[model samples]
Target: MGYTYPVRHQTGTLTTEQLHLLLKNPRLIARQVASLTNEKFLADYLLSGRYDAAGGGVYYETETGDLYTGTDPEAIEPAGDYPLIQLDEGVPSAARTVKFGQGSVITDEKISREGNQYVQKALMRVGNQMVRYVDTVAWGVIASRVSSTSAATSDGVGAWTTAGNVLGHLMTVREARAELATGLDLDTVVLPSAKWAKLVGMLVDDGALPREQGNIALSGTAPVSAFGMTWLTSPHITGTDPWLFDTAQLGGMADEKLLSEEFAAAGQTGVEASTTRISDNDSYLVRGRRVTVPIVTEPQAGVKLTGTGL
Candidate 1:
């Protein structure tokens, strides 16, 4: 699950728990088990409309309002490096429920009466990543010397009027969180300041940051001082990681390599059919007991920091 290097100079610095966390990456795999344990429990077992449904059954994002048309409102923008978002104030609590029998066999006449309470109550305790998902950000800046417009004149550095002039920027925490999901899709991103306390509050209010494992860090502009919480740096799964091996996180997903026609008998429906394919439903599965997988940690748990002058 990991590769470790022994630093001769640093001997037994980390505590027992910290050392374990540093060494192991917790892995989760969800199989296609039609039971209470499978991730389907999250999507299927819950009362319909309870857990957050995968948007479009493909990409995951809460900003259904930002749907694209000919223009594709969420078009990519160019930046010097990775663009950043200012943490917004707060977000409203939006609950998504999973009604038991949307497409399933459970009919209104059958368990609707008794199961209704069970599903709602179950949904309350176990929520989906989408429920806690955050994806919203807006950009703004204050001009030095109080310039009405943003412009760069022919000078060494874009300078304002004098020493008294100053400029600052701010982004809503919600917006900052959303940018992490949509823009810089990361597994676990580190922040400059100590923002865990703030992030923990947001999670307490908004829900977990669309992830069971992995970390998003936020300290201060410097290493010593802290900011609040890097809760906003976390990112969502965009297009699937094509090369990742199939596992439990994928709902009882069968290994794609084994499913291919080459792996299968010679005769296949088509060329792609000849190749291996992952099931859409089981991809990114939840961890469970009845269905077990090798405990794997998030891919980018100790993600290296990118961008200059963080």
Candidate 2:
């Protein structure tokens, strides 16, 4: 309870200085940081260090588990103004950025002092923000070339390919950084494979969309809806499609009917890629300066979830 929640921008186009200010904002700072419970936890434990009692007393156990309570905290994530790669802005008279360490912890006031210390240290701790500006001409030139996107920004359809997969990515923010952090100038985004995995995990963990079943496929524009939230073409979505689901999945609430009524083979198959093609719409990791996250509170709790045939 005494610990602080250190919010950070994992990797965004946002600059270091701007991120600090964003964290200090009235809204962001005002957002309450509470000691919540992650009822359904996804985690791992590690022993940071341990010392045994030489006197034959009880051996002190330093076992630590990284538990994802699955209860994602609500944060008023930061945002930045202007473009990330606006070199035409003359690379500015000077530039800056901030780096922050990210992680979380649980608290147990009713427990012993040692447990409290663990909770205190583990509580949402923020790291020092490292600031960096374009130092070299090449870096500056490329930064200028992109002209307002994030370093990770790239080009693609800017649309969803599959319904379940797409929605899953929208759920959890992550242990590292908020995708839409302050200070990003996302006119030019470069999607990385690591980020894609994160995006996919965010969706799956949230239950908005289940994990990839087998071979992924796209339906012929069926009126797809999840949890009766909205209507969009279900199955697989492509960047070429004009419609962009608000906050991803056709609806914030995934349709329960599909899992109960629909056929097993509705979406795209998890086919291995054979074509050595590098096309924007081919679904490779593209840059993403920032993503538009909508206000969809209250994630729908589903039935006794069990799975097989992995």
Candidate 2's C-alpha runs over 4 A off are: 1-92, 95-124, 128-310
List residue ranges in candidate 1 displaced over 4 A: 1-106, 109-114, 121-310
Q: Estimate each model's TM-score.
A: 0.16, 0.15
On residues 169-266, what C-alpha lDDT tens digit does candidate 1 reach at each position? Answer: 11122233244443322222223222333433443344333342332222212111112222222122221110111111211111112232222211
RMSD of each: 22.8, 28.8
In terms of TM-score, how similar is model 2 to the real structure? Answer: 0.15
Q: What lDDT would each prediction earn against the true structure?
A: 0.21, 0.21
